[model samples]
Target: MDVREIPHTEATEATEATEATEATQATGAAHAAAADATAAALARVRGAARAGHPRALAWRTERLTALRALLTERQDDLAAALHSDLRKPRSEVDNAEVGFTLREIDHALRHLPGWLAPEPVAAAALGRLPPGAAATTRYEPLGTVLVIGPWNFPVQLLLVPVVGALAAGNTVVVKPSELAPATSALFASLLPAYLGADTVAVVEGGPEETAALLAERFDHVFYTGNGTVGRAVMRAAAAHLTPVTLELGGKCPVFVDRDVDLAAVAARLARAKFANAGQTCVAPDHVLTDPGTGRRLTAELARAVEERFGPDPAASEHYGRIVNEHHFDRLVALLDSGRVVLGGRHDRADRYLAPTVLANVAPDAPAMREEVFGPILPVVHVAGVDEAIALVNGGDRPLALYAFTGDEAARRRLADETRSGAVNFGLPFAHLGVPELPFGGVGESGFGAYHGHHSFAAFSHRRARLDVPIGAA
Candidate 1:
């Protein structure tokens, strides 16, 4: 019989099956190509590192300067890509991603000379040596390293580490997050042009490409994401005995004292929590306050949200959408876990979730179960600072702990009692802007910190050198 003579349903099924098979084959081929490209890039970067091309101060300076220029020259391009990926506002893209990275590059460039200088060891510390003996510690590059970036704040999170790696005079292979495909493609295309193809290579793909890159040996692996993948990165690095710096996120908590300025506290909290659609690593995941304070703060927070995003945030130009449908759905479900006090509207089609505040949230609510990396802010009532401290101590250490209080004793108590990566007295997410502070997590958040001088240290090996006369030893 002729193929046209077949039943309509049967023919449709046959065609669909054939298309599926073809798609599967194509996907396999693409993954294979990505793996091959990653392997080749690693080899090229390693070769460059061995050639000592990146070790020169001049070369490092040129790369840093180029990185800054790239950010400045392509600010609009980056902002557009970020908007495509996360619906990020242009102002946020400028201030948070491009501007943040530019600051890092500038700091590294300005301090590179002083940071690279060898530190002399005291004679008292060098025991059992000749009188003329001297010791010094030099900051040396860790050779070709791999930097795996996260989708949230893709440019800043990924390139900030690159600044340190390059500043430390290391050839680098960067793996941009596949979720942010626009930014990833942009980086893949632009990095080679700006930083040279041989010294710095950008590998673009998802888990497959990352797995392939992880399988290969690297001097150091720097990852910024969650703990699940952070563990995987650690495991892969273990095979090669490679050191890794994991910048992972957890449920950061905030405590609102009844004595503080409710309006100011609410404003800061709203700004920090809702920014980037609440996808920030250090954003306040939940609020702990007394029942009265919770009720009052909820009203203030509602006012703050309206003031920031206007009556209808969905219509606001400054408001952002969720990264994707999965996160959107996850956040939508959390809204049911507590009483919605403010914005709770969401549209899956647009991946938009309003800056929602959940009051009367039970401690064991679904939203409280994990890090709510969305625009859902859960407010749980506590007895006071003691209860807040207890709750914070009970859970895994957070990446940041925020408190709004005028009492010095309360501030000191929170600072002294909590085991977090950072503690802010009256605000949240400000510590990251300070280039001098080390930014990372503790416990489940992840290990290893990086920023400014800390970034240089993370990528460098303090090689100890000893000098003595021929017979002095």
Candidate 2:
């Protein structure tokens, strides 16, 4: 049975227009509903904060325990989600993402009691209060905090900040990146069950949803992503006069010394550079060394990639795939920027790119100019340590600086001269694992540090108080 369509008339056209308007109205209403839902959730968390539930040590500990359980009990689920979202290897997922966050939680739990105590401070001599005056500072929670996680390291970046915000006795609203949908959905589903709806809530969506969440006032806003989005977060936060911690990424540099073990250095560089397909914030963005060392290091790097990921890294179980096709294409275009030393293979369909090393790369090349957040390492030739220092100082300070040297003078010079978030002697990206050390960046790379006590301090406001004997004066 075939039926022919009626000829176009004013009445029929008007009916079609009315239907389109209704559909548009329905979409707007749905969006309004979603925004209202987010607003309502945020209001609940804010109410919880005002009630002082999170201020109790017992309450903080209970939440931390639940977070540990979530990681330990449902790790397989998280790993699978990460694999689906970013093609992250199971082993890498366990160590880099899950284990790293667990360590942070453990550290926070152990030190939270001491961290919560009020700290004594010496009274200022210039502005004397009285004859017998005592002063101290108390760490108070900054109400509800908004934690916006990046697509790279979705779980760790999102949850780690929550650990700090919670430990500091603040409720948190987590917005997981929509790019990693599987992980984001996993978090949105699992977090409420573990942390409770009132303490920690997960909101999932893209830029529009993020903008909606940002519209509301928060005590603090912690964002982990590229500088562009970091700036946007800062701009939004400014509307509320809210404090923010921008954990951003840039072209982190590595300086290779001629005296160091080339083989071991190459192996370590490969491990750090290619881990999670080089989507790490502190991954060695480029290598700086003398021409002679560069030649030897280049060959050793080629051997290291083959040894670790095997000749055909695409087939290797240890190697990870790029996050998405857009990133894969961006990485493919970078190969043309410099002479490929070892790896130049890429499969956009599989989102697989080999651990590539480019040598004799110009300083102004695209890979060098931008943060090459992929498994691509570019080696730039420098005259000596002085030249390397000059080059590093020329750009915006990076999140981390890696200098491989046994020389005391060189180490001291590099330590005193350069500006970066953290400095590692031989290894790169190792500073993040240590709970004692603060992880963050300087200048354009980012601002504010957080890990153990730093995390506690970052989320808490230190309010000063003074008590004086009025009768004495």
Candidate 3:
């Protein structure tokens, strides 16, 4: 509100100080004065979004409509950036990162109207009111949105939420992780030109800049990263009283039932583990299979990893490197407690680590204790599904859970007993392969859901509106 709108008085015999005055001010004027400064700024963003102005909506039907074309046109650029920064392959880029993101753009464009439409109500509550009353719920924009994305899958982590914000009629400010400098810069440069600056703005920096952005009041905040930073983001959002949806990493578990298909499990586990060198948040941290099954899986996965990326990830161009030696050393130090069953080689200069899977790991071992985001998968042997569920629930809730089984009853039991936000049955790692699922975490893994419609709703406020029939009598 302006100073004139504050109901201020000049100091004199005629002017009395309101702070010390015991007299009452007009309620309407008091409400106007109490209106937060951020309300107007947020309103402007909502207005811009509603207008779908050329400068505001930016990409609109053109980029949203031609997402595949744009991605195909710029495929080399994206792949090159990921390779330069993360050491991923051209094929991996198209299938994992670019593939799903472009698909999300297309999916959101096609279903955006359904997402944005105000919901209808049954007037159930209105029946309780005196004869002529009625009520209806309305949906609307949350105004300005803040997205704090992670270094791993930096492009998709950031833009996926932006897709939702834009679709739900809101402007977004994306803070891409500085760890992946190349991709971050690429997004900063590419997004604005393709999608205008007014609707979407990318601020490229580290924690300090992120802290500054968090300090600024916003209508909503969506963060994707590790739990430590996610908690800090939550704290900052709380200070501003801003509602946030945090997508954080956890030790997602994978259970292999006795009746499971060993060959298919080996192939699926290998793809998920070595996809980005196992740098993904929902990547399976450890496996719990029967002693017989665990041993077989270990042998099969070793072969699968070798088949997919060859004997040495250091020499394989397909295998990605750790973001830095710090993370490489972190994983290296953790390997001391367990017997290295597969690969454990690391080269600092190349920043390469093999698809290392450790066997005979004790529950208290470092690999089991925390999230091993590297290519190392520790296969922990348990008797059956009950033991596996107990082990999974022993720690905090993971972002994703994978249980491979042909038994229908056992699958439902596993799903019910666990606390993960998402569960995949009959597949080792189902988080990435399925686009229909909403991905997120619970408890320490983090809160909020994203992907498809779940994300579109995350950046919007579910406005509880009531419409009363004027003369129903």
Candidate lDDT values, in order = 0.91, 0.90, 0.77
Could you arrange the candidates by TM-score from highest to lowest? 1, 2, 3
Instruction: Report the lDDT tens digits of candidate 2 across residue range 396-454.
Output: 89999999999999999998999999999998888888888899999998999899989
Candidate 1 lDDT for residue 289:
91
lDDT tens per residue, model 1, 313-353: 99988888888888888889899899998889888999989
Ordered list by lDDT, greatest first: 1, 2, 3
Model 3 residue 59 lDDT score: 45
User: Model 2, residue 229: what's the lDDT?
Assistant: 89
lDDT of 2 at 404: 96
| TM-score list, all predictions | 0.95, 0.95, 0.85
Which residue runs of candidate 1 sit more than 4 Å off their true CA positions?
Answer: 1-29
Residue 278 of model 3: what lDDT? 89
